[model samples]
Target: MCSHYEAPENERLLAGFGVAPDSKLPIDLWPTHMGPFIRLRHEEAREDDLPELEALTGQFGLLPFWAKDRKLGRQTYNCRSETASTKPSFKSAWKKGQKCIIPVSAFFEPDWRSGKAIPTRITRTDGGVMAIAGLWEKWKDPDGQIVHSYTMLTINADSHPFMSAFHKPNDEKRSIVILPNGLIKDWLNSSVEQTTSFMQPYPADRLKVENRPG
Candidate 1:
């Protein structure tokens, strides 16, 4: 599961992904922290009108509107694609179509080849930004304050050539859903069944990794 990531900062990179250059967002993000997300805002749009994509920052972990406390968000930072539509933490967002896209420059994982974990940064081969699929929720705190949060969606990676190498030796490998530029809109608008098709490992040839020394 993705716990840390770099947010896009270059104007050209943001433009390439259809993100507004003026959109406010943090440059780095970690689980349970604030991060940027792109989604169609429909506060006033007609049912037949298409809402424009907007950038907004929210807590990385999703907090269901019915949640009693924000602390639960920490454990919900990553939602498994296989159970997102059925899991208690993410099911409501999935059913309510609270889809979103997280613009990331890179994400970190641990490589255990040396019999210990080494933090490794993974990026696109072309060094462009990647769009990670996610779910969002709006929750009202006890103070009546509304807070928006989100969670990254992940899929099984045990069969993937590259993704399978991460995590512990015996643990099931998992990979985030990195959406291609052409599929961003669909991810934000597609029905639950149709959206399932987007959950897959990114091509290994299009990715590169850099290991951080201990």
Candidate 2:
């Protein structure tokens, strides 16, 4: 599961995702930290018309409608694709087709092969931004405040050539879904039944990783 990632800069967001956010975002984002995501401008637009995408700054973790507080996002930053449609914290968004794309410059994972945890930064080999698949939601607090949040969707990567190398040997390997540039629009407009088709692991050949020590 992914717990941290590097958000794309404003220029990269505009150039890569074609949407410019109104405010500057933190470069490094952890669960509950503010980050940017792209979703359809109109949730209820007709299928015949092409959808317009919009970028918004939202909490890195997803907040379900029933969540009591924003702190709940800390535990929900990543949602498993296998159980997303049934899990309480993610089912509503999944079922409602609240799909989104998380634009990240890179994401960090732990490498445990050397008997120690080394922070590894994963990014596109071409030096482009990664369009990570995600889900977004809106929550209303008791004071009538609306909070926008999102969660990265992950799939089992136990047999994946590269991603399987991360995490502990005893733990199930997983990876966040990275959509190709051509599928960005299709992903945001996909129905619940069509989402599984886009949850596969990205090709290892197109990715590169390096130790990102602090």
Candidate 3:
């Protein structure tokens, strides 16, 4: 449910969205952190900002290997929950709590046709922001530069009466991780039981998703 989230270089920006830099973006990699992570897309990756990247100090992470190497994302960007239980790509985070919440203004999902992609906006019922579920990991390069990368989680959408209208992939094959505001913490805690309970839909009718001009 996320793709665009910003914590503004200033700490104040987070308070409005209910995130704190010490806890979330500019990303503090502390093991005891909570809250959502804003994935920096390929276009958002500002290599010139090494200082901001260095300032992060590993507060949070993504798939250590995949994010470090772009080649991995050809298959790594979105992990299917149906196969997650067995897919080698996501087995580790599934069993463990190396997870992160992906917060966003709106998530971009495509309605695929012959070859073109039609993008839509799926946001909270109240036109507010949201957090998508994610998994994080950290790895080091040959020269010792640490890279923290992550992948967004997905779930089937047939259950979502509104989302299904968009023909979002259901079948438990590929769905994005979305939770009500209250459950964010429980998922972050990520105990074997907590994660299991989180997988269920959050009462679909309560949320609203409308299609915008493509």
Candidate 4:
């Protein structure tokens, strides 16, 4: 599961994701950091109207209605696709169809093949921003303030040629679901049943990785 990533710049957000640019978000994002995500606009329109996408900044981790505080976000940043509909922290968003796309320049994962943790940056082979599948939520805090948050959706990557090398050697390999440009719209409007079709891992050949040695 990914815990750190680089958010796309305002220009990329507009050009690549087709969303209004916002310069307030930080470039580097962690579990509880606020970051931008693209989702279907929640506005009233005619039945035949095409869905509109909007960009909103939200905490990186998801906060369920039952969460007592924002601290819950850290542990809920990555939701496993296999149990999203059943997991307490993610079920509500999944059932409500609160799908979103997390636009990132790159995501970092740990490579332990050298018997040490090396940070590896993964990005699209064509140098385009990645559109990762995610779930967003709107939660009310104790102070009566509304807080928006999101969680990246992950799928098993044990068999993936590239992704399987991340994390520990003994741990189950996993990867975030990176959506193709053509599927971004369908994913935002997908029903629970259709979600399964998009949960597969991104093609290993289409991704390139840079190992950061420290």
Candidate 5:
């Protein structure tokens, strides 16, 4: 299972984000170290957190879709790479060919705080940017508040040499999906059946992991 993911707040804010139609793409801001706080209604942020976010993302000319309520994203963000077509939240998007590509310089993941763990950064070995495949949706609250959010998908680490260990920790759980630029476009535009074929190991040899940097 996947848990957390990382992206550049600046890219989401500034980039036009080329994707198919009807995709409800959602991008958050970065704090100081992380991107900006694009993740409103996090585990604590509330639903009425649009004005502030609009200001931040607007600076870079981004169209930020605020979260409607806080229930779905409170826990349901990432859908598994293998089963996204069957899940309720993702199935619709998958069927309509609604997909987007998230650009990233690297991904941040914390090693287990307990057991055999340490902090690290997983980035492209070639030191280039990556375009991760993700699904987006628009949902609303009982009061008719509309919000848009997206999730990162993950698959089993079958060939990733360094990441296989990151999939499971002693008494802890962690792992994320990192798509390379080579296959990202196809992943975003392909049919549901075609997309599943691209969920393979995500090209482990193209990535490198180490203590967090940048």
Candidate 6:
């Protein structure tokens, strides 16, 4: 699961992704911090057909509409794609198609081969921005103040040559879904079945990695 990542500086990345800039996001986005995500406000024939996209800032962890308190969101920063449609915390959002795109310049994972968690950076070899699949939810507190939160969707990575190496040696490997640039809109509007098909391993050859001391 991706717990931390570097959100792109809006202007530079939006231009690289050929998207028009809308809002600013924290350069270093953490689980509870506000981060930028893009979603279509209305249905569109094509991604570019929309004059402007909705770029909103939301907390990284998804706070379900039914959640009694915000603390539950801390454990939901990432939702497994395999069970998202059925999981209690994500089922409603999944069924309602509360989808969004999380753009990142790079994400961090723990490499545990040394019996310690080594911080490892993963990014695109081409230096382009990555669009990660995600789901968002709207929750209101007791005072009726609304809050928007989101979760990155992850998939089993046990069979992925590169992704399979992260996390604990004995734990199951997992990775967040990375959507191809042109398919960003497709993922946001996909049905449950189509969304499942998009939760695939990114080509290892196109990924670049840098390991750092924990």
Q: Compose the digit string of candidate 4's lDDT tens values, residues 1-214.
A: 9999999888888887667435568999999899999898866742447338888889999999999999999999999999999999999999989999999899999999889988899888999999999999999999999999999999999999999989999999999999988999999888888988999778888899876564
Number of clashing residue pairs, candidate 2: 0
lDDT of 3 by residue, 84-181 (tens): 65777677767766666655555555555324446655566775456667776566656777755566677777656555544434423235667777
What is the TM-score of candidate 1?
A: 0.90
Higher-lDDT candidate among 1 and 6?
Answer: 6
Q: For candidate 5, write residues 1-214 as lDDT tens digits.
A: 4333344444444442321222222343221111221221222343554221121111111112343345445354456766777766567767765555545556655555345445566777776656555565555546875545565556665445666555335433324555655655456557766766766566667778756333
Clashes of each: 0, 0, 13, 0, 10, 0
Which residue ranges in model 5 land beyond 4 Å of their true spot?
1-5, 9-68, 112-116, 142-145, 167-175, 212-214
lDDT of each: 0.83, 0.91, 0.52, 0.90, 0.49, 0.84
Q: Return the TM-score for each candidate structure.
A: 0.90, 0.94, 0.65, 0.94, 0.62, 0.90
Listing every candidate in turn, what is its Cα RMSD in Å to the true structure after a full C-alpha superposition? 2.6, 2.5, 9.3, 2.1, 10.1, 2.7
Per-residue lDDT tens digits of candidate 6, residues 1-214? Answer: 8999998887865575445345666699778888888776664634557544566778899998788877887899999988999999999889888889888999999988788998899999998889999999989988999988899999999989889989999899999999888888888778866778888888988887865554
Q: Tens digits of per-residue lDDT for model 2 on 116-147?
A: 88889999999899999999999998899999
Q: Which ten residues in a row have the lowest lDDT in candidate 2?
A: 42-51
After superposing candidate 3 on the true structure, give the runs of residues whose Cα lies further than 4 Å from its correct spot: 1-13, 16-68, 112-116, 167-174, 206-214
Query: Poorest 10 consecutive residues of model 6 by lDDT?
Result: 43-52
Off by more than 4 A, model 4: 21-23, 43-51, 212-214
